[model samples]
Target: MSDRLRVPSSVSAARTGAPFIPRVLSIAGSDPSGGAGIQADLKSISANGGFGMAALTALTAQNTQGVRDVHVPPVSFLRAQLEALAVDIQIDAVKIGMLANEDVIVEVGRWLAEVRPEVVVIDPVMVATSGDRLLDPAAEDALRRLLPLAHLVTPNLRELAVLTGREIGEEWDAALDAAEQLSLDLGTAVLVKGGHLAGAHTPDALVDAARALRQEFPGSRIDTTHTHGTGCSLSSALATRRASGEDWPTAVASARAWLRESLEAADELQVGSGSGPVHHFAGLWARGSVMTRPQAEQLASDWWEIIRPIRDGIDELPFIRALADGTLAHAPFVFYLAQDALYLREYARVLAEAARIAPTSEEQAFWAGSAQGAIAGELELHASWLTPAQGITAETFAAAQAPATTAYLDHLRATAFDGDYAVLIAALLPCFWLYSDLGERLHAGAFGEYARDPEHPYASWLATYADPAFAESTQQAIAFVAQAAASASPEMRERMLRAFTAASQHELAFFAAPLTVAL
Candidate 1:
């Protein structure tokens, strides 16, 4: 019989003869609080798509409040743990954190030499988020020696100050200077995080010894006390994603995005009194009563039913009926196309906002591509209708925005400005699902004489919506909304549903407005 491992539905299973799963090993002290050190490292690795293993270097009696005591395992025992893992399993990446003393650091460095992993990310854990010292003062030199062996070193502002022997003030430029110098001295890439700085924006940069800028990730600073293991999470995520074949810049970008999402969901968790840990699996956890992935998938049909009346209203609209029968007047159709072209420009921006705040790299890229497709595909079709006779240039589209158009665009912008990504995506779903459903329905009937006849005036436009590519995009958008809703809180899920229904109503109004206008 073949050996197949049992795993959580949320995690991938490992089969004996199947392709190897990406494995990441964390060598660090343990925190009893389960927030930082090896605990955080393993969580970060797993959440960022890696199977995590650990070699404990020490144990700390700690809580969210502070570290009380520390006990170092014997160097020989630490060596045994590393060697045992090396002999039994293949490690794709290594995250080294909190090597408490000189002997432990030396042992870890020697093991790195022997079983050299492809990706090594060192989080120089000098000071805790609670301002407690984790690394011994005398072991700084040993940690420095190990830096050259690392593919990347991550240091917060305070740690950067200690490593470079320089003062990093309130200005972000000072930290950048120190990070560049540290990278040069250690001959490695350094990630300088600007979270601790006093500002509305948190900016982090990855730079190399040659002063080459790799990636710069910027974010609006979240106001939350639950930042216990942020550095550990980012560094481990970087290692895991890098080992899984992301380039340096892409790994950093994706890791930072994961860390921000964890911060956004930290308030949902209540672990301790003092600075609690960020929720590592925040994006993956089902926040409402839905317990399984299959249950979540069922929400798609449920949501469609909930919005059925709005769908019916759109299908019954006079404007839609006229278009389906090729009886729509030229003037109203031209006016609608101009307004739609205007609508798409702002809609593209809203999608960009969605991409910026999405919880995962896959989601981010999906939204970004959706934004581009809106402009290049849908808007191009709209523009084609207004040219030659309508004299509608890009400037003309901007000026022709109607009251209904402004209302819809403003509502989306307000939701995006509120910065609740789940709600924003929910608001956007109508543009995809409703349009595709209506187009497909219109395509199936005898009434859609225009859609089937090349001689009909609006045939080309109707085909734009019924295209297979547009249908696939609609399915992807629906899947994303359902997935995000499953991972949102009960209250947040309710908010999403409300947003979806309200936007569906807007879609009905969008089509109806053209009939009332005298173009």
Candidate 2:
């Protein structure tokens, strides 16, 4: 959501030398069920931000229950489809799935060898989720020969076992070993998926056959039966992300995360009776138009209204009242400032971590500069009271940090380290937003005795938050978070809101803690 990360408008894309869109080609069969094969592939590609194109290999008269019939296209026509697309369009990536026969596989593989698209993801779909054979057994050898052509091949446990000529045990170790073997033999990266394994986690590993680079992506298994097109979706999403300029590991991680969200939201769609398809546009649906304005523009206003009760409660707290009236004792205020200084030290590190993982350079710079600003600007205000005139140090600033302070900082640290980037930004937002809101209100002398007075002791402190520069920074943070929420999946947008609301509640606790301390 950085200024640099702003997506070019479609007009801008057309004017620029860069591609107007990442064009993904799904070279797979048709799924009448709309839950697998090319249907699902196109959905996955579009959901992950790409332009999707498909060349049908075959047609299946199937539903959620199972495949009823199949008709393979003539090999000559199949080659025509591939050639037509290769010659006419710019293909950024290709996802190959469910070739019905050896002739089909050889034809597509020949096109692949000829064109050599920059990114190729082959799903190796041998069997359907309904226990129907998709690829002809005679084509298995042809598929094996085709493996080396792909940049990455995604095979579920059953497919992995077949490809490697090994029995897949229930333990995930078997899949990992088989993936390593397959990668080395084929000279391509292999993503060994363990979604079928009876476990609490859906753990997957990406193994580079030639390089021996292995990265494990661990995610809690989403308890849903509507995972019909998971493999097709994963491979297509991976290809799309790669086409959009993500590294192998990052692309895989992002694809998996998006697929899981789609899985969780799959039940909402009434596409079929058995396992339904994942809702590709769940993000767009959940973030419906907010009045007449765009979702991102409405974010700050929406969140403020959503947490109105919490804000009301905070305004009613004794600590806030006393501070506004200048009736708060000097000792508790000093104690609060010391704990704040301690909190800022840790807060700065979390911001730095955010900067490290930000997808865009502008976002990275914004977060990095914010970290420095926190320590050099806000902490400096606290240091004026806590430190000696000479300088500040750990010994001088250290105090018995309040439990509220510890809890809030721990939540942010956890988000910074483990949560999604959008969620982390949401967690960091309340500190900027709520403080700015309260400071602006106090500066207006709203329910405050000495805020408007020139001689008020904490006037300078309140002024820092109300400063125009600080308000501008807070607005930028809000805009970034809102833009992210607008684009994120429904589940992720909810997570962002939860993080925001939880942090807002903690802000209330942070202020109240000083009132309870014995002066």
lDDT leader: 2
Give the RMSD in angstroms, all C-alphas superposed, for model 1.
15.0
Q: For model 1, how does the per-residue alpha-carbon lDDT over 346-456 read when each residue is reduced to its tens digit?
A: 999999999999999999999999999988877777766766454436554754678888889988998899999999999999999988887787776645555577777
After superposing candidate 2, which stretches have Cα over 4 Å from the reference? 1-20, 130-133, 288-519
lDDT of 2 by residue, 245-264 (tens): 77788989888888887888
Query: Which candidate has the highest TM-score of all?
Result: 2
Question: Which residue pairs in candidate 1 have backbone atoms (N, alpha carbon, C) closer than 3 angstroms, thus clashing?
Answer: none
TM-score of each: 0.54, 0.54
Deviation from native of the Cα of residue 473 in model 1, angstroms: 35
Model 2 CA lDDT for position 67: 73
Candidate 1's error at 228, in angstroms? 0.6
